[model samples]
Target: MNDNLYEIFHNVYEYKDKDTNNHFLLTENLAPGNKVYDEKLIRIQNREFRTWNPFKSKLAAAIKCNLKHFAFCENSIVLYLGAATGTTASHISDICRRGMVYCVEFSSYAMQSLVSVCEKRTNMIPILADARKVEEYLAIGKVDIIYQDVAQPDQIRILKINSQAFLKSGGIAYLCLKARSVDVRKSNSRIFKEATQELEKDFEILEKIDISRYEKDHMFYVLRYG
Candidate 1:
């Protein structure tokens, strides 16, 4: 590892700014010189790294909170649900440079931005469709990972449906569950518990991280689909 860069996971690097003494989670820029969501970029040894903000990305928050399972690889085929404006999805595109990131978004407003981001990165495929309707994206085939960040009341059901449709056996999934979206009336703990129970029926819970510090009323789950 270079002195300025530390490999936290495959293609994921940690960069500490010398000026502010602030450490940042970074991914090698797959599309060099291109700004995704206006994230800061750094150059070291002729390589570019994009600072992944935890506040803007739940996966970055999970990593900052010590998430153990890092399943993304250079060749990972990812199905990213709720890829709003391609913020987190862009980072995954950097990590999985040799693979594919199928970005699904329901909102036309968000999809417009996602499409521009996809145009720059060849690995990311933007899909304008609802995540709950898996049949629309069945052409993507089985994927190595399913990343769901949808904020609907039936978020778990959406994940289950997509997992059954596209997730490969023993594949990994990163679920960013928004408790308030599930049930604003119920407590966050109660919503998390119920969601976990529902997920346990289809996936083995590998690691669970409470990311309320970065994203309020949200629970980040790393699971293995069997």
Candidate 2:
């Protein structure tokens, strides 16, 4: 892994390691090869980099499952909802090196940690506000992407509201659907069906990937706003 052998896979660099079949995100290693929220770093090309653990991030899990779309890119403006402590948000920031990540989190306690992560990356912004209230961040204007990982029953509704306010037309969105959060008793497939039905009204469902291996009872949705 230290040979610096790297390949770009949908805006993320993958390490050529014959030891394991796991996929990883190539980060600039903002921190030393230490654990940031339980994520590890691997050195490649003589550059210290962090390994994007799939179990810790749905976006990483989707890539592990062969997701085709590369939604985020350099200089891409992104609106991230439910950015708890900036775990996945950090990886996104790594991919969008020249871009900005507007992280919206309601918990003040979590925002504190997120701010620490932002200090290391100039492009990352930490906002303490509820995702349901889009007006709070209306000044951010339109963004290229909207990523929502909120664990609420009305996650789809919340995403729709934020997309309408901040996301530009033709923008991409990655939503982590936690079936258990929506309904504890309903079948996972049935919950997904119901959510898709609601989301189809505003955005086109690009791809629905099962990420249960990393996050139990979860599905990752790739959407394109019309």
Summing lDDT over every window of 10 consecutive residues in candidate 1, give the lowest-scoring window. 1-10
Per-model C-alpha RMSD: 0.9, 2.2
**Cα displacement (Å) at residue 195, model 2:** 0.8
Kindly list the per-residue Cα lDDT of model 2 for residues 156-214, writing each as its tens digit. Answer: 99999998898889999999999999999999999999999998999999999999998
Clashing pairs counted in every model: 0, 1
What tens digits encode model 1's per-residue C-alpha lDDT throughout 1-226?
5686789899999987788988889999998999989799888888888999999999999999999999998999999999999999999999999999999999999999999999999899999999988899899999999999999999999999899899999999999999989988999999989888999999999999999999999999999998
Q: Show pairs that collide, candidate 1.
A: none
User: What lDDT score is found at residue 198 in candidate 1?
Assistant: 93
What candidate 1 gets wrong by more than 4 Å, as runs, is none
Q: Compute the lDDT of residue 48 as modeled in candidate 2.
A: 72
Query: Which model scores highest in lDDT?
Result: 1
Worst 10 residues of 2 by lDDT: 1-10
lDDT for predicted candidate 1 compared with the true structure:
0.93
